[model samples]
Target: MTENPLKAKDEQPFVIDPIADTGAAKWSYFSLTFSLFYFFHIIAKYEQYTNTQLISVFVIYICFIALFFQAIRSTGKAVLKPIIAIVILSAVGAAINPGTNALFGYAAFFSGYYFLRKYAVLLLILNLAAQISSALILDLLSPYYLGPSLACSFSLFVYGIFSQKEYIHSCLQQKKNQQIEQLAAIAERERIARDMHDLLGHSLSSLALKSELAEKLANKQHFEAAKKEISEVASLARQTLSEVRLAVTGLKLQGLSGSLQKLTNELKNMKFDTQCYIDALNLPPMVESTLIILSKEWITNILRHSNGNSVSIAITTDANNVTLSIGDNGKTAKIKPGNGIEGMRSRVAELSGSLDINDDDGVKLTVVIPLLATVRSNVKNKAIVSV
Candidate 1:
């Protein structure tokens, strides 16, 4: 089966670790020259081994050096062959030269922490034994700095553990912040809009009715009630309409990001997993507001009609155009055009954008506006969902 690109984003680690991104120093990583430092140390005791033994050890050491940085940086299954080769080479290098284990153990320590964490303890133990056994075999155990050597590897191990924790914390923190901001933007406007609309309509209707009745009462010379009603009507009529109108239309949570974030939470409540890929770049007020309204309407329609559980909302911009797509796995073969859909079309048409609806096994609502050239700049098409 073909994997969905959207689901791949979910499986990625959210944290950007400083160490893993750039391994060692540039010169050290590329040249494979760091291993030679240990080679010279073993060579200082030159008479013990013949030139043939030295050359063979050199050949083995070079191969081990080649994978030094990669072992630390690449713990993926793709690097499995190199990792196995390096582990064998590390043991062989230790037999020829005890100091070689200390120099190369950095690779195993870091790889254990980041990629192969489940076996980190075992790798560390084996690495320590490699260092110690070399010293004992060469009768150089007393002279060897084995204690500090092991401690140095352990320090890297400790840092790796914390780095993993930091990555997890970063992921959780991002998710928490996304939910809070989305809820704050979504719920605040919804609560006030819904409550005030119901309350104001009832109040205005009652006030208008009483004022007209008061007008009749004044003709019958019931002056006191008439005076009170006329005064109240005069005060309330202009005030209610002006305030309610503003509250209903003016105070929408601005920007495409916040608005879409809120809509995502709404879909989540309806058992729909919504992924929104809104860019960090700001759009023009008109463009942003249009998308904000359009996306909300799309989600609202899907929740009302669909049985599917997944939706992906994405916005992409290039040098000449801006495209917004909302897709769902719903039954769209018999979609009835309503005011909401009409309004969505009208809104896009006003901006000289085309609104398209695809109704195959699913529905995909796409709006492309070529009129917003200034708003569309160089932006990547990759989906950065929430975090």
Candidate 2:
């Protein structure tokens, strides 16, 4: 079974360490600066302590600072051990001298950050209990120490929660961006495959037919006719090569009318009586490119499959839509959708268009695409440019 992404995210170890990162390290230094006040407080009253007592407090305070830094630098469960040590040192330091009570705030913050909510809360309660017990047992209970210590602990704990949330959000956003890039790459590859098929399919079929016609004429001793057919084949091959080059360079078809006329000539070559009609319409490059490619795909299908001798091609535009229809008086049969047909559908769908195929009389394809606002804008821009 596929694991839920949110659940997996919770299980993954954090990849960043606060103390090891430049920006986070600066903030760590800023927070650690506040802990110096307690260290200095002990120093200010050093005259009241014997040598043994003073040395013990100093050692405990140093160990607490070292462990605190280590805990922040560590990742995963490795951080827990040092954090637990810091909590113990905080309690021991408080018992030795109430001035070091502020150390418990640092412990509370680490526990909240490095653990889940329930575990962090339990650790927090333990820290509070340890502080209160030490103060009450040593007759050191005072509002001046207890009130500020509690406030600091809660404030830092909340800050830690917010920081953890921010980090998680950042990681998720990065993952989403990567997925979007992968999807775009796949779409681009499919587009190239579709374009190559439309460009080469018709040209290859025409070449094959012309080659056979030339060979038959040569066998009948009609040298001039055979030579003419071979010349046409060479010309068609060069044109196909140029189109492939332009397609690879991401350039759209330059002249829609010329392309349509060329298709009509190819139909006549196959002895098909073709009728063509095109309206005077201004279309955007992308729309024109899609129309030309779809036309090629349909004509190629007719040449390979149709048995009739007549074909009709029409392109017209009204106030609200552009329509393209291609039909042939061919033998009608069950139309099984193939890659070429599916590619045409995909192209039309991208323009928010509809395609219908009917085999009642003969095979006919009709496509209607709405006149989008962007298309109207392009037409207006072209009119201004012409003026």
Candidate 3:
């Protein structure tokens, strides 16, 4: 079976590590810092070059120093440093020596292509235009000229193509995470709405009916019957309150047996016959809660959609997994599932279980969850080893 795409957000780590992100930014700064110091040291000791050579080195050193400062200055704006540094260094490299310029320009182009994800294409275009124009200027000024610069310029363009793909993938990952979070929030909201509707709608309708019947009985001089009806109405209201509280607190103290018995009594009072059976005992609390939730949702779906008069609920557990199946005799409705089924699926998927719904012959929903025996055993062994 395919993995559920709507799994709970908290069950898995979503965002990449903040430390890892900070580390990458820090490394970018550290690399440029080292580069600036190394190049500056060379210029400081060997300043006997021609005026143009000294000027070119000075420009390159200043640009790298600026990049180091910018990369560390603004924690949130690290994207600009690589882009600016790459452009400046590419220029200085080309101006100094055609051969060396070709190499350094390729490096700078790739750095920008990889780091400045959003504007990668634009940076590549700009780098290409500048390098080509610089090559033409060099050809006019010196014999050792245009061909090498053109080759370097072409190399930078070609390098950007490969790095651009990686940059785009990073951009896509960031967008996908945002979308997942939005979708998870929407799913959680729908679940809450369904829980509220189930808790209130049935109880309110019953309350209204009981109130009407009690009033009618009192008018017919059936005071004792009217008093009894009032008590039942109060009991129903208290139980509904408890259910609402349980749903809100999300406490698993109400095990599968308690939850099912509650459902059976509630439906019986509401004039629907329910039969529940279990072949499991002392199940994991999480597994028991999962079963209860599944039972509640299936029952709710039956009441709202199937119009079924009878429901059969069965639960069984083996050493490795537990299964719960609920079936109703009434034919399935053609009505689409709104919130109930969606919430059931979400809860079951959180436990790494599968919920199967069959609309044929009768409405049947089945859920299966893995037992945690192996995990418990592993923990026990680890404890023993530590001792």
Best by lDDT: 2
- lDDT tens string, model 3, 1-387? 332221223433111111223433444444443343334434555655677876776676566556545433332235445455655575556556343343334334443433333344465566656666666665633444445545555665565455444433444554454566568557756786799898799899999999999999999999999999999999999999988876754333346777787777767876777888899987755567568767877787666766668888899988888899898878755637668788888888887889888877677878898885422221100000000
Residue 311 in candidate 2 has what lDDT? 98
lDDT of 1 by residue, 78-177 (tens): 3444545665566566667665655644545454444435455665676677667766776656545566566656876676667555544444544454
- TM-score, every prediction: 0.44, 0.56, 0.40
Model 1 lDDT, residue 231, Cα? 84
Error of 1 at 159 (Å): 2.9
Candidate 1: stretches off by over 4 Å: 1-85, 95-98, 115-118, 133-142, 145-148, 206-245, 248-253, 256-387
Which candidate should be chosen as best, given TM-score against the real structure? 2
- TM-score, predicted candidate 2 vs. hidden true structure: 0.56
Candidate lDDT (C-alpha), each? 0.65, 0.75, 0.60
Q: Write down the RMSD of all candidates, one decimal each.
A: 16.7, 18.4, 15.8
Window of ten residues with lowest summed lDDT in model 1: 378-387
